[model samples]
Target: MHLPIDLVMKIYYMILAVIGVPVNLVAIVILSRGKCGLSTCTTRYLVAMAAADLLVIITEVILRWINLYYFPVSFLDITPVCSVIAVLKRAATDCSVWFTVTFTFDRFVSICWQKLKTKYCTGRTAAVVLATSCILLSSKNIPHYFVFEPWVIIDNVPWGCATIPAYVTEPGWVGFDWFGTVLTPLLPFAAILLLNTLTVRHILVASRVRKRLRGESKGENGSDPEMESRRKSVILLFTISGSFILLWLVYVVHFLYYSIAGINPDYYKDSISTFAQVGSILQNLSSCTNTFIYGVTQSKFREQLKSAVKYPVSSIIQLIKKKQNN
Candidate 1:
């Protein structure tokens, strides 16, 4: 029936890592070019998102490659290695959220409200948003460093991987799991829902406005034909945002089940491990999928991605020809 847990996690992570490289690399380049009709203010935030996603894919590749090739069962004895991976995981996820939510608010202001085009929204402003979000998230995760200290004895022994033990930290902080995972990320989910909703609503309202304008000019009776096309694009973009929310919700639910219910993790250990891997990978997909969403829904990001990918290779060939001539 079910595959071995470790085997499944190894395979899943490996596969997702393999998939993430090219996808997120494309994101990094497209966003970097600022060619996606991206305003100066908003491009940097998504660039940070793309960059963070790129680094995250790298770490995922390392962890997966190590898990599959180097040390499948144990062998990761270096506390700093684990700590660094864990820290980077937190950093990437945190920085990514900051970029994501900042972009959400950016869209809200730029599209829905239409006031920020002239105001305090520029490349520098997006940079500051990225910085602030990273700082705040880093502060939140700082406790992990002091709390997850390596017991020298644990490493010296031969018990598979050096494990992070439970209940070894300060008593007050020891069991406050509910406050950590569920409640914290939920606030961000709520914000995402609110802002993304407003953005979608505004996009819809504008489409209607354009259709009304079109119909009045053409002397048509009911609705403009182009309205259907705009509606499909809006729906597709909404689906991308919806994907982010769904994956995070699954993660939060499972996390709350473990933390709040005090369920024996072993009972659902197989499922917990499986879903965790899936959710983790899918969440990272959000970082890369932004480019795809823009590519599909916007046309401009797609053309830009195509040109960016092609132009560099053409330049390399041209350079080679000139060198040969010289």
Candidate 2:
């Protein structure tokens, strides 16, 4: 039987939530353990990112699934609960996205401005930055809790979360879109682009310098494993940032176009909505790939993950077998 597109999207979100939650959880566990003894700044930012992604999956994606399937029976239809969930979703998504930028900036400093790393890129500083970011973003999202209300339809109690009717027509909404799409996303996009470009240039020049030094010194440290680690981290960040750009760029462009060009959003509802949905799904899918990227790029993460999972995974399998036999 064929399902409606709406149902298909709900199921897609369900699939994403199921896959993303555990993958990000594993990343949080691995990053928190400091198994690789990498810079604590990197560890803290990565752990924060992983935790934010997990929360988005739980509070946004899975809760959305319940709302779509359960309708009036879902807590999502309640005004307070819906508002809180919406705020949580926005906060978590902002944290997850912006924390990636924070991580990228940290790497940029460690590599490009090696002098500043000693003073600025400490674990304590990272903790402060992360805490400040959370508090700031959460505070910014507080208005959303007040703005979103439950809207009823077809004699149903309430369908979903939406801005109160008055707010939708206000000029503030255009500013909101501009801030959400442009200031929030494009600023970091530009920063990451500029920083990563300079970083790659520095890595290449540094690699050449290293080669010359090795030639002159003959028996010095072989290839500087520290440089190698930094190189691998650069490659990993490139992969992740590239994915974020690809996933979000279309939506950003569309939002900016509509906002700046003074096009009515409802005008393209029929035309661009599918594209928007695809972008949204891709963004959600992005949250699931980071752990796999870590696994591919870092053997230390794999080792810690195996150590973390092996016992409980096997015991659960054995229990399942016992239950099957009984």
Candidate 3:
């Protein structure tokens, strides 16, 4: 029997929270150790991305979704508290998307602009970039706090957060909403595509030139270590960015439709509502994908993941052996 969409979504989010939390934590732990055969700058970026994804899972999936579905009434539902959570959720989401953009750009520069890569792709620079992005993005979401009002007043205390009715029509709030939308997935989508396109173009040209220089154009087919290294980097870069683009595509389309049609999602018809919900599901699903992408594209990451998976069993076996000896 087919289940209700609402029920399906509830189950989907519960499973997502269960998987997303530990997956990102594992990725953060593994990448931060700097033993994944990634450069310091790349490691820093991956760690930051994982941390941002983890926060997204906590705020968006667990706190917002699970709390809404399961708890229904808790301290987190208080107007002020939920407003802060709203800001954090938006900031974390923005960081997650923009971090991917930043990493894509870093890889693009490293592959296409060798001279600039030495200066821009250093660990210090990566840290600076990530910190600045975090600060600015977090600050960008501060205005969201003021957009909410008490859902209900209970004996002088605000019970829950609801967007002020004026949020849709008021000039300032409308402008802010538009600005935030444009700043995030919209700009990020364009940026990643543009950067990836340029990187691919550059690599094709460079490969041809390098091949001729290595005498492969004439007859001799020899190994080119530089190209091989670049091939791996390109694979990782494309997989991560491509995953982001595909997963976010539905959300982008929905956003355009609703914004252009000037229709609030709350008033959507059943089919349209399901479409919107699916878009949301896909969007949150993006948070869980980068870890799998790393595992697939980076051999060292897979190795580390294997070791992490075995550590508990290994420890248990050692404990059993020691007990027998004792």
What local distance difference test score does each model get? 0.64, 0.79, 0.92
Location of the lowest summed lDDT over 10 successive residues in candidate 1: 159-168
Model 1 quality (TM-score): 0.77
Error of 1 at 310 (Å): 3.1
Q: Report residue 171 deviation for candidate 1 (angstroms).
A: 6.7
Best by TM-score: 3
Q: What lDDT is obtained when candidate 3 is compared to the true structure?
A: 0.92
The residue-level lDDT of candidate 2 at 109 comes to: 87
Which ranges in model 1 have alpha carbons more than 4 Å from their true place?
1-5, 72-76, 147-171, 174-179, 182-184, 203-239, 263-268, 312-326
Clashing pairs in 3: none
- Estimated TM-score per prediction? 0.77, 0.85, 0.97
- Tell me the deviation in Å of residue 278 in model 2: 0.9
Candidate 2 at 280: error in angstroms? 1.1
Tell me the tens digit of each residue's lDDT in model 3 across 62-166: 999889888999999999999999999999999999999999999999999999999999999999999999999999999999988897898898988876767
For residue 23, what is the lDDT in candidate 3? 97
Question: Which pairs clash (backbone N, Cα, C closer than 3 Å) in model 2?
Answer: none
Residue 160 displacement in candidate 3 (angstroms):
2.8
